[model samples]
Target chain A: MADVAQQILLSEIAFSYRSQNARVLDIDRLSIDAGEQVAFIGATGAGKTTLLRLIDGRLFGWTGRAEVLGRTLSPRRAAPRNWNANIGFVFQEYALIERSTVYQNVRNGRLGRTHSALSLVGLFSDRDETAVTEAINDVGLSDLADQRVDQLSGGQRQRVAVARCLAQEPKVLIADEPVSSLDPTSAEKVLDLVRACAEARGATLLISSHQPKLVAQYVDRVVGLKEGQIAFDTPAGAVTPEQLGSLYGWHVADTAARSA
Target chain B: MTSEQRISQQRRRVADWSGFMVTVTVGVLVVWAWVATDIDTGRLADSGGRIGAFLGRMFPPDWSVLPTVIDGSLETFHIALLGTIASIVLSLVLGVLAARTVTPPFIHMPLKWLLAAIRAIPLILVAMLMVGAVGLGPLPGILAIAFHSTGMLAKFYAEAIEGIPAGSLAALDSAGATWLQKLRFGAWPLIAPDLVRDTLFRFELNIRESLVLGLVGAGGIGFYIQTYVRTFQYDKAATLTIVVVIFVVLIELVNHVVRAALK
Candidate 1:
């Protein structure tokens, strides 16, 4: 291990679905350093999710050399055992197990780190239980810990998802449209939580969003994708209106007008 | 054209009320054909008096015969429970294999077809075949129920697994979860309630099926019903029928409780 640096590096990565004749994602190179809060902004279907999947190590059978932390990425790299302990993911739909209690769902973040067979048998160590409770509290969901996820509002469910990620105590947090389902206020709250948690843990945060305004508001750097390739890599303040227009084309004016 | 004329024209193009009406008509026709073939309303009317008389005889349910029927009903429950257990375990594996989200088409399609073939065989025939092959006992009944249940359970389980949000599995995969780990964390949690509810529902169905299996000498209350009816002991026959109904209703209640807990 090369000093266990907090960075993700990808080079010559390409991915495509079985049904897709053309590649959905093709990246020549990309890197995010330790503790960097990077936001990916792109038009719809611009391979934002695909790139996230590449970093997350979900897409296989792709031509690529990537590394997260000190581990090298390979087609033969086994599905991550203890990957959850190092990387946390928040999904667009929240993805909290609907049938599980909020506590159980949050506790799942620790699943990669927790002792095996014990959690499977529905038993958790006292330390694990405390971690779960603290995670729920961190997300401001202590009152709803016992509630089933299906009963929760969209915002609450998103919090539960955050709590799940929090429990993992990960080194990197990757969120894929984490608040696209929420109202504006709730979206802001989720973004705030993501920022706070990422900063508190000194963890690298990589979030993908279609909303450039939100990304500009919270993220340190912005990486724009257009047609499955990097369009711009710049500091959040440096992402000018012209760059935004080039990234989204004619829709940038519509987005700016709507924001106005 | 007037606004009303334009609106009506658009409605004519967009609203397929005629198609809806045709679907309803076809559905009614199909149902009518089925009823005409399988049901004899006139014969039912003629036999209503005898049925009423039979009901009168079945009154008080011969509670003294309860002990005799209890053992068989318990046997039926045991058979269903064991069969459900076996089917649930097998279905989990087969269902994952058949699920397109979990497996490649080359694997999923064939597993799906295999389950469909299993489902195509009627449960009674399966029981009969088991009885023929394994000799007359609850074991054959259990085997029959398991086989029939494997098909139904696998089909439903595959659908349940498929219904899971792809995002969670993607997240798990990204997190480096092995296929089994992905299933354990991402897929299993989402589908557990559905699996439990479906298994309970299947168990209820199997209980009824075990009765049918009794005709093939698979020991249960159905065997007693067949024996009493054949021996012309109408009283014992009525007693067995009442017992079976009560048993089914109780199982249904239990199923409801299990579903509630799972939910």
Candidate 2:
């Protein structure tokens, strides 16, 4: 177990955007193995996003021994400004450039690895073209690759975002509410693509979702979060309805009680 | 019954009081402005006959100097075009420097203040200074318009750039894109249309300012108009006035179409 690299190892991590006392995330211990697909399950304001942001280095003041992809985070200094070449973040809002073509949006995923001149001038090499084509193909968007991202449906746009992530060829992929914006049918299709793509690349996938059952069959593990701490970490198949009810305590005790 | 009688009635009373306060404040401000400007109906009644006499003199506009006025009008248009182009190019550069998303406060704050300082100086005053420096011509007018417009355009560009949401910006950052790359992909798409619209507006505004500068001897249609009126050639001045009005109306129509197409 120790031989293989730990993709994420955050312990006793605490952070707050407002003040030292008003902590938003206070995870005591969290770990993910290489190539592990883990889904974080929590209601709104339950530190799931804060945890993801902490790993992504979007949030700072990590009060404890927090390390990501083997790099140790420091309390005295903020996280180092390095290119996150091996990590992919799928934002909930689809975040694709509205005016840019699907190919152009997906090509942005390769920006981390592409030469500055190549990316800015948009003079993609044969290799760059191949990568972009492959990513578009991966997301099943080849027929509409020339279309602008804003022209696509909500589901198609999410797929484009996933394609952009796949194009990055990241070793660790973190998706924040990847399916929340999609319709029921679209959400299923998007999740399948995300799962299949992650498996093909063997990337360590960490996704956060408010709905537990929505992602139960897709992710191998479900980590429940409450308030600012980890409430439970269990295999996806084993998460009981009661556990989900307790996790989403924002529904209040009445709702949880009624559900029980 | 209690909700209506006590709560709703109290809310209505509060709203009426606030409305009355706003009305009285506006009334006071308007009265003060009227007093300060010495505006009186009695004075307007006294001046009506003289105003009518002046209007009568402006009629039967002389057409002999039409060619000279045309030359001056073209110069004004050219000044506005050249100045707008120069200012827009400079705005694109300085706007990026001043953007909060792109620049740290160390750079952004200083650039913002400098732009504000540039805007604080009246364009007419700048034109006068340039006229003195360059020794009288539309060159000074062009330079003055460009100088004043740079401050305005850069500020608007910064606002447009800042209005872009953070989610897309964060996506670009996480993808290992550099600051310049992020701006190119993230900021440019959202801001380009607005920047184009703002450039058109500045051009229109600069055209009017160019005419004003011409009155001060910076050399445009207004220069001819000022010279004509001073020499008691009201007819030629009236002709220039008609031409200027027509030119401005045409430009405004073009501006409307371009802005609509951009949207």
Candidate 3:
């Protein structure tokens, strides 16, 4: 079902806050083909998140000709009902319902596809339940499916977030700094689970991160952002210390020394 | 010492003086309140002996009116329970509107102020109004408690809603959740326990308030207590008081166990 049109295309995109004097994001052009796993990496304020948010359809009031999933995209967070069915977003904090079980959190991912009345009453169809169970198994949390999210460990909670997105059966999956808040081992594990799941589903995965080394192995291409603009878009293997130094405002010699 | 240190010391002295001034102002306000209310310390001292004599008469504990005491206590409990249920139902709706995170300022501000305005009037005052409007019965007392408690519970609920991570709301919002769906998935889980605890706490307070509403002819234990007191039936009033104390203890024990379970 992959169309010839790019999965994501933003041309002459510029977003600014009306309250602020300067624009936070100003991208000349960017495009991602269907099923491409791309990583956006840069310093803290480099608009990596802004770019992902735009494609996720959670941002508004942008000057751009944006087309996502082969349709003209609005800058607003919503369009026609179910416009966001194909896009799923995973927040940095896992964002699993602390008071709810892993099963419910994962099941909620398919909410957009279901009848609103069913979800309003906290019910899910058998089809939704199957997808949820499959995703829970995919994330290796099937044993903890009935367990409350608050009862789980941090890494386990992050896995629940990944499972939630996977259960959505989305065509485009966006994860914003997914591993930034986890311990090193947990971070690696979450990344592995998310990367493996996205690949299996053949979803267009867009991960934003400041840790280049962590994301390099997961993505085929890396787009380096500098002050709200893409400084470089290259194959992940082609990224080097020099480009990294420029993205994070590190001196060339300092980055080289660290690498050496 | 550095000039900065000397300046810091001077600022500390000024802050201490300001704190002292605030204490003095509070003291003055207290004095003003006592004066305006015409609280007679002499009368309080004079009543000490009478209070002792009254307690002396109650040492044998009259068990004859136990049934009446129990009946009044049950009525009070019923009123409190019904009011609590109604308050929680209404607060759940109003609280979402009061929360600034999900609601726009236009809606949030007015709802917040309305809750505050409702809360400004004491439950007993509301009960009196209800009694006046709807005849003397438990219905008026229950309605009074529900109306007043709605404001109190809504404030607590709104705070609980606002206290959780704002990012959680964004997570659900990004999922293309409807407003009700966002509340179900985002807000409900975060605030459910707190809302329950607050409701229990309000119910405990409502029990006490319901009795007072009864004193104002709103119908409950307070009506019996008022009748006993007016007719110098101190032993019966004392029995009713004992029942109320025991009832409150029971409610607190339930609250403690329920709160622990929530944890």
Candidate 4:
């Protein structure tokens, strides 16, 4: 019963590239109950992206026990297609098919749910189309649904990415630096949309970002990382400036200057 | 002068020497080719008169062979069409097998070398062998074109597959797309235009090569050219030549339209 409530649980996770001796991720333990919205804040090379990839079930060759949505992940083999559909990932680069229309790209997210043979020949049920339409409308791109993704603005492209992920109806949503390339205004809008959508669907949300102050305002929990290890895990807005400064290796004077 | 100036002077001297060597090599190669190939300026001058006589005979082409010319030309066009279609099918399979992004190096590397070896064989040589094995006709011509063009078409397709941004496929994979779905959604759209362009280019080349296949009795308008020229029926050969020119121009026009539409 306890496992039923836990959306993600990890223990004794340690990972490193084959060519590197230093571990890239060494989290001792992590647990997130269903519907919890969390953010991972770190500087560059802090393994935030790698950790998100691991939780998304894409990263391989790591030593760890990971359970997401009550299914334990095998380190050697890839996750099953249904399991993958259950955990949608939003890439930092959006990763939309530039030549495809927004509606088509969003429809791709429904592939795992459709009949494989039918989808191969571009056939989809009405349910799939309905989900795709709803996702596009939810992202406020219903008018631009027929337009090619390459013509869209960066913010619109990210919104399309969100729509694609939303179409999956995932139980746990993971975004890796989804707003890193956007302007501040767009970033806030995207972040607000992501959190709001997660809340609307009652899905567990996990996002990684470098902007701690800005990101903390979105998620209820913030887990700060420093060189592949968790430095602090506290409630959002409860993370002190000194803690963030130290996590990013800022001197006391630098922190004082930033506070001023 | 400073050491820096000395180094600059040395580099300039090296560059000048390399340029001189390259020019000298090219000149020597040209002279060697002319002498080794036994090209004679006097014989070339004498041949102009014979060529003029040949052209005079071909001026009023025999229209009596129009039916034969039309039939042979259609055969050639059919051979090219079938060969291009067959090559496209083979290229799709071989191309994916040879793409480094699709398959590991151990699989794709050997396949690449095999494709290169196929490309190295001349089309005429392949056609000759096909005629020997298949007992001549359009079958040999079709087989030869299919075999010969796959070398280039597959390589072009492999390059097209490799040109896709890796992240696009990875994104699909993360979204739980099956292997075929990833290919359909991720690889297909990005490479469809490139594949069409390559296939059209190969089709044009196949048309040209199939024209000559008839010289070896593999079947095409080239057979009439061979027979008429060998039998000294220059008037008939001239008619076949004109029809061949029209066919080639028509194909080129269609190819241009298709490529434009793709764009």
Question: For each candidate, what's the DockQ?
Answer: 0.44, 0.54, 0.56, 0.69
Residue-by-residue lDDT tens digits, candidate 4, A1-260: 64558778999999999999988999999889998999999999899999988887888999979988888988888888898888888889998888899998999899778888999987999999998999899989999999999999999999999999999988898988999999999999999999988999989999999988788898999999988998999999788878989788998789878867
lDDT by residue for model 2 over B108-227, one digit each (tens)? 999999999999999889999999899788889888888999999999988888778888878877777887788787778767888899889989998887888887667788788778
Clashes of each: 2, 0, 0, 0
Number of the candidate with higher TM-score, 2 or 3 = 3
User: Which model scores highest in TM-score?
Assistant: 4
| Candidate 4 docking DockQ | 0.69
Rank by TM-score, highest first.
4, 3, 2, 1
For candidate 1, what TM-score does chain B get against the true chain B?
0.82
Scored by TM against the true chain B, the candidates give 0.82, 0.86, 0.88, 0.93
TM-score attained by model 1 = 0.84
Weakest ten-residue segment in model 4 chain A by summed lDDT: A1-10
Model 2 residue runs over 4 Å out of place are A63-67, A70-83, A250-260, B1-64, B89-121, B132-135
Indicate which candidate wins on DockQ.
4
Residue B73 displacement in candidate 4 (angstroms): 1.8
In model 4, how many backbone clashes occur?
0
**Winner of 2 and 4 under lDDT:** 4
**Model 4 steric clash pairs:** none
lDDT comparing candidate 1 with the true structure: 0.82
Candidate 3, overall lDDT? 0.86
* Local distance difference test scores for all models: 0.82, 0.85, 0.86, 0.91
